[model samples]
Target: MIRPFAALLALAALFSAPVLAAPAADAAATPSWSIAIHGGAGTLQRKNMTAEEEKAYRAALAAALDAGAKVLAEGGEALDAVEAAIVLLEDDPRFNAGRGAVFTWEGTNELDASIMDGRTRAAGAVAGVTTVRNPIRLARSVMDDGRHVFLSGAGAERFASQRGLEPAGPEWFATERRRRQLETMKAERVGALDVEFKFGTVGAVARDQAGHLAAGTSTGGMTGKRWGRIGDAPVIGAGTWADDRSCAVSATGWGEFFIRAGVAQAICDRVRLAGEGVQQAADTVIGEVAAMGGDGGVIVVSAEGETVYSFNTAGMYRGRADSTGTREVAIFAGD
Candidate 1:
């Protein structure tokens, strides 16, 4: 039999065990998985948006953030999280990626998307793909198929069919808002420049609990685009890039300037080789794009669990969430 003092000591030790181990257990459970996402970046001003419109956008952004956060919290991979978020945005009519995609000058919807895995540097993209329900999925199929890194036009659609991807007719993707925008742009004779249409694209970047990184971008090309133009969204190093040694990046902006500046890869290169922090790299690269007379923004997740957002536009539709208890969803420059 134990004495009263000894019994109290034993109980004390038992209670103290969890308390002593709490820090390690908590640290293990919270692996600093983080994510950042963007709908687009361009001439979005708060005054231009009605309260109802702003609320709708915020709801959509929050929903996407929750989707990706659920994946990360449930121990899913970064690639899955990125894809899940973009897939939701693609289906939503409010953004300019899939169902709500802008029409070309010919009034057809041609989607483009790209995905990258930092683990193996495996990347895939599809440009000018019509009839793909979700271009992001098609891009992933390309990566998983391993036969090619990029596919375009009817060929990509054929590959999508062969891979059993969901299909949609061109009309299914054409929304009245986008058609009106196309008509307006045509009346104005606007070109493929992103300035005409608010730089509308959707993208995500994530660092998972397993320490893997991934990035993806999807777009409807540009309003009034002609000749089967493909934006940076389908260009791996331009709009989407991921590397475990540095970070994952997804950009929305002027595709030509992003391609010329190598925006995505340059950010990672600065982080990996120049030892710059993720935010610094993002800011520097985006600044260069601005200096080159382009406007846009980026969402990034570094392998070290840093998340960043950098843009040179009036507004960017963006959100972020992480294991560290950070959560945000915002639009407009000051938000």
Candidate 2:
């Protein structure tokens, strides 16, 4: 039997013991699997959108989410999950990717895409390719081909043909909406295109049951872009990046600024080296881009299954899903 004072001291010691006072279970649990995606980021205001248009965009985003979520739910690889989702967006004429890519100064549609696999630290990209039906698929082919990390222009088209990838006719890519946008840009005759016209890149990031991470981005480049310009979408570490030890990221915004800031990789680096949470790292990176006068957004997923959608613009078409059957889609800033 201890004295009252001794008992009180013992209680304090027990409470202070490191083992008994061990930190609470990590709030950021390693999820079984998770995925996040973004369609584009820009001045997407409610006034500029009709109810029907908003509904269509939301439906498309949901479809993409379902495509990727299905793969993840079935225990597929993260790489496969990202590819599945992006392919859907690429085919949808509503987004500026494969089927609905923007036109170049030459009146041709040039698509760009990149993909990264964190488990193997492998990546592949294609830029200024006009004929690949789905540029994301070609990017994956390049990665699996194992001979090159990037391909561009006629070479990329030739490689895709050689690899038996489907070839898309120019008509298949040119939508009336994009053609009208090009006319508008030409009429403006301005060197700097508007952010609204430059939006509509599609991207996805995922973590699989095996704990591997992956990211992919696809875009039609900029409207009225010329001189064989290539944006960040096809540049590894700029528009897209992934690492099993850090996180995966996909960016959609002004390509030039994103390239300059290394937006995607910067977010992952903050998480990997600075010990920042996924949301915090993404917020910091997007803020840095905004400070540089760049408007865009990014989707990030940590190794522990944390997901973040960070943007500096008025809105970003985005969505998320997990193996637990939770799914959400939003386009406005607050939603």
Q: TM-score of each candidate?
A: 0.89, 0.90
lDDT for each residue of candidate 1 in 138-183, tens digit (9 for 90 to 100): 9999999998999999999999999999999877798888887877
Model 1 segments beyond 4 Å from truth?
A: 1-31, 191-197
lDDT scores in order: 0.85, 0.84
lDDT of 1: 0.85
- lDDT at 227 for candidate 1? 89
| Candidate 2 whole-model C-alpha lDDT, 0 to 1 | 0.84
Error in Å for residue 165 of model 2: 0.6
Enumerate residue pairs that collide in model 2: none
